[model samples]
Target: MKLTALLLSLSLTASAAIAQSDAASEARDAARDLEEAAVALQQAESSRNRIKALTQVVQSYEDGLAALREGLRRAVIRQQRLEAQLVQQEAEIARLIGVLQTLGNNNSPTLFLHPQGPTGTARAGMMLADVMPALNAEAAELRDALQEVRILRELQLGAADTLQSGLDGAQAARTALSKAISDRTDPPKRFIEDPVQTALLIAATETLEGFASGLTDMSPEPEGLAPLPDISHRRGKLDLPLEAEILLYPDETDASGVTRPGITLATRANTLVSSPVAATIRYRGPLLDLDNVMVLEPQPGLLFVFAGLGAVFGEVGEVIPTGAPLGLMGGNDPKIDAILSQSGEGSGQDRTETLYIEVRDGKTPVDPSEWFNINKDR
Candidate 1:
């Protein structure tokens, strides 16, 4: 009355399909980049265009690190599921082992000599023939599960080294960027701010709105400087000034119950902040509690404002091209362990620093979300 074979056969009949996952494939590339991170960092530091080279290096390290963390997260979850499955199948596995052992023992005469003699023996042999495939299948599954767990364990163990390398490379790149910024010449200026006029504006303006409204008078564009191309045609398709995620949309009420007219972005620590388009720097400095603000006039009557920078680059009235470095975000870069821990929670954002962005068209605050395509980045 051994119904174990019947039960196991039933289980086999309900076998699920193999699932396809991106974790392994995407991470495989990240692993290769991690191995090369150090070399890349060294090369970047020595490059003539240190700022651009170092920026790419830092971003690449961040990408590789993110991929690695994602791989580990998925691998851990997969391993857990496999182990749980194996545990739950313990009784079935024991029965399978018993059946296997009985078949393996050539000296067990009772196996062939069923109680009803020749007729029973023939029937038992036929039943064994039918169940052999299912037993073999179950054993194969068990082997595969064990093998996968071992591979995942090895991946996790090796990850610590790769992650450390990425962290080191990222830090080195940041330092290089900082040094490069200090050495680089100031960008071309479309206008030269009168010291007295700038000082008076700063003293009189109570808010970012007031300052932005008076931007033309603070630093009027001179006649000789070439004007930047209008980006009106590219509305809703402009890149963000940095790799960031929108934390608060325009007009969203925050915990303080204050409604803001701009969007707040969450970005990684020490990451590069750039000008999204060719624009004139109306102003670049600390204002009120909004530290290190940079107001860019991309087109006549249109302005883009950025706030909360650790260090602002370029002088007021400078004309910067699209993608020019503007500033660096403030906050300590997250440790690898912290990144991995956060990855496991299914949100791979290490954005500890916040940057506020405001778009102004003809002196009125507009939603930045309408201009920047942040969804694709996320």
Candidate 2:
């Protein structure tokens, strides 16, 4: 009877343990369900918010289009100027060649081979000293003119390419703008609650250091954004965001005596800017003199800053896929023409759009040439 009672007690204990385990599992399941429901509710809210948040992006596209149109106009003017310059240079080069040929034929071989006497030799030497320098100078001029003509021809070809790109860029921007306006569900939300306040801070910060401080302190919360890829390993293999010419390299000092730790590309007007790697949009808007700037972080410490955009896309804290369209370079900025004129990257009067790209590791700037492919063929 005692043995029977003990078996009964053991059975009761086992049943109680099973019951507790089941209760704990149900509790965990309930918690998970609640978490999921909360996420769903947040998404619903975000979707509602995105509807009203598209104005800036649409305005950016319009700005980009205007810039592109301006760029195209400038490019045409530049092409005309280039053609005139090319014609003048070609004519000057031909004249220089003729003059050089005449000078070469002026008894130079005969004089060198047979000097009549000491007096003749001295006279010949004197003639050579005076005439040789002149000849050399003229030859140099011819060479320079020829080089200039070649460069002009290349610019002419490039001008055509730029015009085509400008047209395409404008179309792309318009389409994207329309889509962004219509699409309410997928638009990314601000990492922080107050984006205008963040934009103010970004605009107010004069230096990248200050910007970094503000951003790092913001406690950005990524909601429903995909995780970024490991971007530290891809070196010398990354393609440029645009098929544009690189005008400046890392650590190179510009005319202003400021050393840049990034690369500057001279792209066609209204050229579309894209991300080379999967990244999160850290900041978007003008910061200092750089108009319509956008910042992307591919990893925790690595950040890419692109400035001089005419229009911008993507929201802060949004995780974007590799090669995703960010925005279009502003073609309409008069400053672009000035920059191109200074850089000599334009065909004629119209300057190529300048895209200033700064890559940073933590708060420190790094050379983007080391990470990106700098091939001439793009």
Highest-scoring model, TM-score: 1
Please, what are the lDDT tens digits per residue for candidate 2 over residues 1-378? 232333334334333322211222232333333334334333433454432233233333334333433443444344445445545445544555565577568876653543477778676568657655655554454455445445434543444334343334335434544465446355565354577768778667887667866765666766655566686689778888865667777777877887777888877566567788888888887677778888888888777888888878777777677766777787653343453343334342333688888877777777776678776344
Question: Which residue pairs overlap in candidate 1's backbone?
Answer: none
Q: Model 1 over residues 1-378: C-alpha lDDT tens digits?
A: 264455555365325412334455556678898767767888877788777777777677777776777787887777667677677677666776676677787686775788998998888788778777866775676676677778777777777777777777777777777778778785578888777888888899998889888875444747488778878788899988887778888788877896889988887787778788888888888888887898888888888999999888877788877877888888887776776566556553677888999999877888776787656343
Q: How far is candidate 1 from the true structure (C-alpha RMSD, Å)?
A: 3.4
The lowest-lDDT stretch of 10 consecutive residues in candidate 1 is: 13-22
Q: For candidate 2, which ten residues in a row score worst on lDDT? A: 16-25
Off by over 4 Å in 1: 1-25, 45-48, 102-124, 216-219, 374-378
lDDT of 1: 0.76
The predictions' CA RMSDs to the true structure, in order, are 3.4, 30.7
TM-score of each: 0.85, 0.50
Cα error, residue 359 of model 1, in Å, equals 0.8
What TM-score does candidate 1 reach? Answer: 0.85
